[model samples]
Target chain A: MNAYIDVSWPSLLIAASLLIANLVLSAVLRLGMGRRLLVAGTRMVVQLVLLGLVLEWVFDSANGPAVLVLGLLMGVVAGVTAVRRTSIRFPAAYLDSVVVIVTTAFLVTGVSVLGILRPTPLWDPQYVIPLLGMLLGNALTGISLGLDRFLTGVLRDRTRVEGFLALGATRWEAARDEVREALRVGLIPTVNSMLVMGIVSLPGMMTGQILAGAAPGDAVRYQIMIVFMIAATVSTATFGVTMLAYGRIFTSDHRLRSAGALGIELD
Target chain B: MAPPVDQAPILTAENIGCRLDNGWIWRELDVNLAAGDRAVLTGPSGTGKSLLLRTLCGLDCPDEGRVHHRGHPVLDQDRPRFRARVMYVQQQPVLIPGTVQENLELPLRFDINAGRITGDGTAAALLSRLGKSVEFLGQRASVLSGGEGQIVGLVRALLLEPEVLLLDEPTAHLDAEATECVEKVVLEWVDAGDRAVLWTSHDQAQVQRVRRGPSIDLGSAS
Candidate 1:
């Protein structure tokens, strides 16, 4: 395969042109979303441009400390976003989400880097950044969904939870069903996307690689590996977040802190 | 009446209060359930009858005062042990998903109540007393009617043989006959052992029929 030809700035005009159809449709229909769409589109462009600049710098330097700092930053943002995605609130929920998300994302990223895709020391940044970014992004969705379902389910089943507690159930036993359901709900997206990988739609990483002149077979291998890693990261992070959040919401005295005193804040 | 108040009162609460983010539900309420004592906890809606029951069984932390189970403050006792003895059965009990037998036997699965589990014979005997047939054990718990759920809840608590039952309107949804079956089971259970019960009921007749001790009335919200 020929070395990938770089698309210049003028070529981006063609990409930007795609937005005109949405703008025209929204305006012609007098839909109020046109302005919001314009604002969102502009912000997305600005964010991606900034990301491109940052990634270029990191790719050039490949400094160990700098790469780690960036990885931590991504994880933190992902963690915060996960918490923000949930409609429920409790005092320590944010801290729990961040802790679980960052720990799991870094754990999976490290394994994929040093263990599976053993790129040489210099290529570490290239492998670590994307790998961590993808894992963190997926972890954000999974953990957030898990957190949302878990707290919601507990609140919904407050009476049942208390009933179990009243019947000599430990906090873990009372909450076991809710946690299991939360994990299942959080993992569905990753599982479904994997289910339809090559047939329904080409995965983003593989498409990008193929576009950049990598062989189809190599791109498919990377995509397949990523699919496995994503599944792992999502399930582990989701399980961690829900269980940690469960511990936060239920008191040590076999009480659910969801209904009356020390109640969970529902936003 | 109330078996002579002879044995450290199976459960005791002095000036215990229930507070939420909004405000206090009840304040400075006191209750005592001695061996063989049967008392009805009464209050208008929102007066915290349910909250008081929860507070007594160690399911809720009182914003004020403390709960004592068998002479030990709730904090000092092992929680599962404390709760095992003073189980709080809800008005609409939440049955774990599965057969009614699963819900009834759930406490046995907990280490605190393990090894004491009897066979289905005892469970069926108790359920039959509550008007549930033997085959009722196999019915999916999720499909039990509100009244049926309350029966299962009581039977489940009985299977654990809790020393005291903090029943929060356990028969509120039952018809006359079902309610009688529940009262019979509860009264028989209390009469047979060291058990005590603090029950809340909307039915005035139930209060008169069940109480052997002076009733506790948390006066209507001011």
Candidate 2:
């Protein structure tokens, strides 16, 4: 039990039998979620299985370029997910999110891998891919939360912002409060998770490592390092995306662009 | 305080235009506010009077023409300074989250107002003159009535000693007594320095009282 327990296809099928409970509940309650649950379950298995095959090849071959490309693709996906989650949107938001995510993900992960871990070859897929994956996964939520707060906040605070502008406050001066609040909101989850890191429950990364037979202390250290890296990535991406969105929302003349000009859409 | 140096108009608009989302509100409009000028911007409710005042203050862009502040392009390189020179007071006063004094003091903290105080006049003095107590400064902005908010907004702009105030029905929310007090304070403010006001009023009586210079009528616009 202390070592890794390999799960074959039959074992995976046994684990998946848990879905039967959901199906049974749906039939008994006449809940309409059965088809949705089935589709979602199918998606998860297919996506993860495909990921496993791709990850296996990259790890075995130790292909550096493939890891970089895959990491960028992950960032692109993360960026799209971040924008999609926002209830209100402006034009070219996808571009802002993608660029910010890719750059922030690379910058933070590269610092951790090169500066902290000193991984071999610097671009080693084993170290690079999973770290980028985890950072993107977390940064996605933070960036989305930040972008949504900023867009909706400026609109809601339109009068106050323009009031400042009317009296000679620069655009930055006018909107700094909203920007500060958005950053605070986006960082809340990361800060809270950090608060209860060890005492409340074991983190997912630590649990996974412990299950794979890494020493408890080693796993704990790794989790701490990764969490710190995630905080850095998330904050940086959130700030970057919010500032970019602000640039788009306020015109060069410093007027809050007409909502029509922004082509704002609601999800 | 001194007699005038250049004697240029405090604020100027040349062939300006404005547009709403659906269509043009007005176009090829020209208006100016000079020292001792008390101009009126009159239009129907939806005919773009507020937007015109915003354009003069550089808070909104003019669609077709230029705005000048004391002989310089108003919306050019140093817009904050231009805005400081030409203030816009909203019809319904907008205050930030804080006490009334805090809202008034926030704009004075801008780099444009760094060391730009005009006189020994204080916000307390202004408020008391408007029949509000010195304690009014400490009142929460959220708790202030509509007329109180308008007074705070006016006092904040006057504290900056703006050369021009693009007022959009500033007295609309005030009762007759407060409106008289606001009009007197504004008139005194204009008389005290080389300043001007571009006023908008739905009330015909206030318009008659305040119109001492040019009038911008949007009544004819279709």
Candidate 3:
């Protein structure tokens, strides 16, 4: 009785008109993005279609390890994207990024799937994969913002931080302000989104659920949980990445490493 | 008067060299500071006077040589305590965004300086020596003039009762009266017989007034 209407392949082909419209607009405006737009649309279609097939196989097999491996693969991809988002460079950045994203995603998704949602067959591909994707994606954005801000802040306030060091401050004391500011910058986006949730816009997860014929109240509850999970994931990931990255900026002797370490001037 | 030459040097820099992005600032530089000694670091512009002072305070590491505090190499474990005793004041001192008193009290909040907090009258006394009133401590730090900010920085360093003070052009922006006030307070601090001062000043008069001992010319070393 709760079955939902599904779009057939013929109906889906009709959706291609939107991309045609965009391509025509790019042509009329003489925008250089025409080729890029075409490439992007093609890639999206190919990737999503492939993902649909993969998910169908995954859901049918319901293999716990396979689902877990897929989630980790998604995290690694997100982690690489996150590192490219920041201009600052340090030792082991890719490893640090992956550690933060994967750890936070696992923690949040694990808690939601096993403890809160408690779906049958705990590693159920349907529940675990989507939740991990959502958590990892948001965590990547938060951590990249934090890493960029903190590194830039250190470069900007090198003198002030050195002043603290000269005054006998521990390394943590020297960088505490910059770290706090970076974490705040990372959290602000999620905090602002939470503030405007539902009233201004329907979030992706909620809208998806509603389109699948879920009741409005059920969709809203899922949206609320997802937002909280996102906020938690962002906080943890940002903190973890920022703290881990500080080791590369400051030497073991507690002195600020040379500008070469950050590939920028601190003077 | 300089402390007796027999007193052991409180700090020493041997064959020290520092290189910035461009080139070598100085090399094979040697210096010694004994208790109650007044040493002036004189050099031409761009001769690394500030960089040398930073090295002395362990804020920077020398590329080629070692710095010893009381005969022990200043290692990572020793830096916190070493910097506590050897304070370096920048030419343009930085203050946190707060009241003057808050800025002065900032160091005491650190773990190393915990329980070493100055009493109510301590900052007031240091300010009075600089001809600043007790009420001056309440003024916003950001609004203070350059001379006033430098004076607050001096008081903050002085409050810590450091064994050696490495002052890098501390009076570059002060008026004659304020400079004189700073000079007098520094002289009184060195008069304690167990402390040392290494100051850099472009002003010949101020340099002559402060150095009771030999002046180290960094320009020659470069």
Candidate 4:
């Protein structure tokens, strides 16, 4: 038997069994939760297949412009998703927020690929795509949660806000409590996940790297880098969105335009 | 800095029109509450009397017109400044989760006019005026009855020393004795020149009590 077969087949079998068991249990329970699992699996299969084809063609493509176009498209999709997930109206500041988050993610991914890790090909799909994707995913989640929580806090506590306003507090002053509360909630999930990482969970990126034949030390090092990148990107993006969106969402009169009118639909 | 104390027409709403859910509550509502005017806004339910009071204080924006306080337009940036000089008391009182003094001082602490206003004498006097001792300041708001709470809410607004006071159904929640006590305190406070008082009341007795000033019947306007 091949050495690779001994290492890989059992892992592959376990993964297949897990997927099958998840589907079977969901169906037997007749709960909608299992449906989401199946949907996620289908989406993962389709997205990976399409990405595989795209990377195969991109690897051989002669034009540098095609790669640039792909990166821009990815950034645009990420920006739209960030705004959409908050379900709040985009203020002019949101454009700045999107630009900041996407640029930071891109810069981080570029630094990892070009300066530090320096994989075989600078634009190698194996390394570059996943790094950028992870950065975008974390940034999007952080900013959206921050924005939603901030706005919800302000809208729910009208009397408290009015009391502050009537007391000679500026718009920002009245919103100060709500703003802090929102930010704390936004940061909690990320901080908790970071704290429990490696002890309670073997994060996906580390596990995937190990499965792909990377040394355990190398996988852990890459995982640490990813964690740092995610924390930094999330902090920056969430702050940027909160600061920018706060201006548009409230009138200078200190009255909030209804949160519903913002036309944002969060998932 | 605080505004000039003796300015005329401390609050004014010019041709104000407000609509709620496709119904006009009030339209072309004009009012000029000069310093120490001590006016009362009386109307039947659903006449937009409360909306008019809110508009004058810049708490609610009118679709058709503007509100000016002491010559300053109550626009967005100027709102906090304007609100500092005015106080809007709602029909239902909402006391912050704290002791009486904490609830009373809530606005002052958050407002930019903190140093300019005095809460010490006001809290003590207000509690006494509403038939409560100064010791009540240590009591939590959750312990107050409806009559006691409304009186506390009034005292909280009074503590801010707002030049223009907007009261919405202030006495509706009070017993006769508490109502008289609150009315006596408010009227006495507004009696001093340079303070403007405009209030809304469903109780005809309140209208009669402050009957000396011009009464705008919003029900007839509609």
lDDT of 4 at A3: 23
lDDT per residue as tens, model 3, A1-267: 257898898897679988788889999999978899899889998988998998999999999888988898999999888888987756577899998899888988888887789988999998998888888888888988998899888866788888888888888888998999989998988998898887897798988888898998998988888898999999999999888878878876768876775566444
Off by over 4 Å in 3: A8-50, A53-69, A116-123, A217-221, A265-267, B1-7, B21-23
Name the better of 2 and 3 by TM-score. Answer: 2
TM-score of each model, in listed order? 0.88, 0.92, 0.87, 0.86
Task: Write the residue-wise lDDT of candidate 4 on A45-158 in tens digits.
Answer: 688779778877876773456666666667667766776776444455457656867787888888888888897767766677778788888877777788778766666566
| lDDT tens readout by residue for model 2, A35-94 | 899999999999999999999998888878888888989999999999999888876899
TM-score-based ranking, best first?
A: 2, 1, 3, 4
Residues B1-222 of candidate 2 have per-residue lDDT tens digits of 422437667776777888877878898787877789889888889888888887777777877888866676644558877888788988776787799878878776677787765435487899888999988888999998888888998998888888888888898888999999999999989888898998999988889998899898998754
DockQ rank order: 2, 1, 3, 4
Clashes in model 2: which pairs?
none
Which DockQ values do the candidates obtain, in the order shown? 0.59, 0.62, 0.58, 0.54
Q: Residue A204 of candidate 1: its Cα lDDT?
A: 95
**How many angstroms is residue A142 displaced in model 2 relative to the true structure, after the best TM-score fit?**
1.2
Most TM-score-accurate candidate: 2
Best by lDDT: 3
Query: Candidate 3 clashing pairs?
Result: none
In the range A135-175, model 1's lDDT, one tens digit per residue, is 98899999889888998888766776777777777888878
lDDT of each: 0.83, 0.85, 0.86, 0.74
| TM-score of model number 2, chain B | 0.91
Model 2: how far is B64 from its true place, Å? Answer: 1.1
TM-scores computed on chain B for all candidates: 0.92, 0.91, 0.94, 0.90
Worst 10 residues of 2 chain A by lDDT: A258-267
